[model samples]
Target: MSDSPSSWPDLATLRDRIDDIDRQLQVLINQRAECAQQVAQSKMAAEGDDTHFYRPEREAQVLRQIMERNQGPLSSEEIARLFREIMSSCLALERPIKVAYLGPEGTFTQQAALKHFGHGAISVPMTAIDEVFREVEAGAVDYGVVPVENSTEGVISHTLDSFMDSSLQICGEVVLRIHQHLMVGENSRPDKISTIYSHASSLAQCRKWLDAHYPHAERVAMPSNAEAARKVKGEWHSAAIAGDMAAELYGLTRLAEKIEDTPDNSTRFLIIGRQEVPPSGDDKTSLMVSMRNQPGALFEVLDPFHRHGVDMTRIESRPSHTGVWNYVFFIDFKGHTASSNVQQVLQDIGEKAADLKILGAYPRGVL
Candidate 1:
């Protein structure tokens, strides 16, 4: 622990120590994998074909504990992430999981999927958000990941609207910090760039930066940032606004990095699956409520939450296809459906609303 070189171990000594630690780590990792396999075997014996290998709540608890017990140079998030991959690998030994996301690869949604499920889960790219939902609903994939909202751009209406007709439940959530980068293909000149392409949300997220630096350049919105990067690959006078993954995938050079207007620009993604997630102690419940076209209806819907002391985090309204001027409210609250207070609040709101749908009660984002 001394700062002076004289008190520190030599470089060779440190290397040997690290090698010994690495060997121990390898054995421990394999032991964990063996334990995971045993867990799977136990489940198969107890429940036969009905066994559920992935428990969102249990994983959340484990990761939280990992972060809490961490005492090292690595940050809490960093330690948690390391354990995340370890858990992911162990779970794969039990049973590999397939995940679908809105993408052609190198998209933020794909990153979110990988972040939440780790590289062990097979990630399949879908062309649209709705398609991602369809895949999960049809049992083509075990789960799906889709953008729910952004810190800067607000709610993703398509994802919200998709929930209206889908039976998929929110198993978990992922919050990914978005970093926008301006990049160009090898053939493109930095000074000669006249057109820029990116997803609409990415473009909006970096609007101010673009105005300042590429004031005269044309901004074209594409299907996704990855697509934008792909498009610019053949254009000499165009550049792409995307993330590091996209840049690396398309072999583009960053003209500027972290160009988003907001420094903490982030996106929240929801994990959609068929099974309901049990309470992870810390959880969030999402609901879709429909109200009759009447005065004070919104107040009636919200009054119960206030009365029950339940913290409502977000509320977004979308037009209901059922009737004219009808709207559906998507509400997220800080508690599980199993909680007594939440049950009481739901009962009160059920009496006031035309229809109440429990979208999902899921663990809050851990990473």
Candidate 2:
């Protein structure tokens, strides 16, 4: 009852109160940053300069705690993101982690990298997925973010293949809601648009929408959505299909939004790093299993997971380079590799499997 309209503060009074709160928030945030700096100094003194200041497990636990304790007008994710940015800034005060993503900039990978690492991270855009892997593998960057799968379009085979060749371990994961938009340059006329440029995957995702609305338009596939956005900058009768970030980056205007066939079209990305992430209590493990070409070989690989009471989250098969008809199983399951149940099943599978590589057990995406 005390929060009734009659008891509400006036506009001037409310603005003044908000201003005071903002001042307090500014001071507290900087104080936290200073403490982060002190912590960094303490870590360096104790463990030397080679110490890792950015702990994915610790960050995940902190975000989960923030979400669990949150009971407010704002959504849990909204508050978690606020805390994420704060942590990001504080982490930068300690040391900025350089992350490489599959990008030319303004792409979905860039968005995911920023979402998981926050703006404080230094993001390096690589031309290809393999390049992203190479950067992380070579220690050129602290981490790499690459798309693993999309809900609508299925798996990104290139990313998986890159992982097969690389030695980098999966450290974390992030799921991004993919929002495809039809955008155009400032001089482009809506009525004059006859051609659309986008990546092959984007075009496929929006196939139904294209059939319904712009069936006659020429659909050209490019290297990336950002590249498509780049190409359309000088053309009058051209438009690009990309995300909001690309539109803002190239000064393009959105003519249509969310044109993907599935409403909840989302992509899951993995954070690849050199060091293995310690268990965050709540975690998921990804592994690649290979078996000789034989009947029920798939069953042999998956049955242990079933019998062990382990939850297998995803499974995909990719061609094995060793032979023409051979295949490898890429699997994701819930549980840390260090846990008893997971370790038991992994050991059992290793015996029957031609080769089993523990990719890494990492905290599931918190935001």
Candidate 3:
């Protein structure tokens, strides 16, 4: 350590350099903010009083470009997050947007909301998924974020059914890596875990881990993981299973971490809003198709996508509410509705299916 003292900076010298760099960064950041404000003014001048300041498609493109050009000590998500906050601040300067997510705070949906909209957004916690949908439908919030599917647990049926009742369009999507942890409050008896609490899905997710570790412990299901965390604080002989966000919020200690059965467990969330997003270069379109009850109905509905060379990403079927509405399928595929081939595919599928509704076309998750 002493040998390279001549070429290396002393502690004081390094501190001084850091201070100078920070000052320069602060100045540049303010300059960027000023430019963003000017952009707002220009948009107002051109689009009048009813200008839409937040464009999910445009934001996705910017984040994608930033990620693509990054050559850093930080990961792409880190860089994109830094930019997200900057954009959040700039968007606030123009006009702040409200985001509604399924939460009581400290839920994964809340984390996803902050991830997509940044900390500057006014994110409200809704009691249920339908509440989030209603908030967006009533224009109470600018957008809503809800879980569509999880890698390990499969599709979120509630979210899919919400689309059937709501007119909101899908504007963007975010995929969050889920890490469920076993946590205990400060006064909890770690050795005497008589009961464990978590959401039903979360409990199912960590079933094997629980079976091996706390097989004799009483497994209780709650409304949400966050609620479990909240309850664990008052129960001395209990523990809660949740994520880092909930643990931090409830001041709980982690007894076990990332206990999900799958190593790469993740959940896909959709951003729903009133506005229709124009095509970003890379986009995915979601649609709902109700097929007639017949032998080849499923194949007839999907055959059009194959014939048009339209790439299908996912397809999930839910039971129809009515007799004629035999099979309801939620389909996600590449390309926008505006594209000719996609239009042709839709036309073909419309003929085959009893009913077809284009849910929305949106930019693919970039970060």
Scored by lDDT, the top model is: 1
Clashing pairs in 2: none
List lDDT for all candidates, in order: 0.92, 0.90, 0.90
lDDT of 2 by residue, 228-323 (tens): 999998889999999988999999988999988888788899999998899998999999998888998998988999898999998999998677
Write the residue-wise lDDT of candidate 1 on 1-367 in tens digits: 4898879889999999999999999999999999999999998999898688999999999999988898989999988888889989999987788999988899778989988998899999999889999999998999999999876555489899899888889999999877999999998889999999999988999999999999999999999999999999988899999998999999998989999998877889999999989999999999999997889989998999999999999999888967854869999999999999999999999998888899999999999
Candidate 1 similarity to native, TM-score:
0.79
Top-TM-score candidate index? 1
1 versus 3: better TM-score goes to: 1
> Worst 10-residue stretch by lDDT in candidate 3?
149-158
Ranking by TM-score: 1, 3, 2
**Each model's backbone clash number:** 0, 0, 0
Q: Give all TM-scores, in the order shown.
A: 0.79, 0.78, 0.78
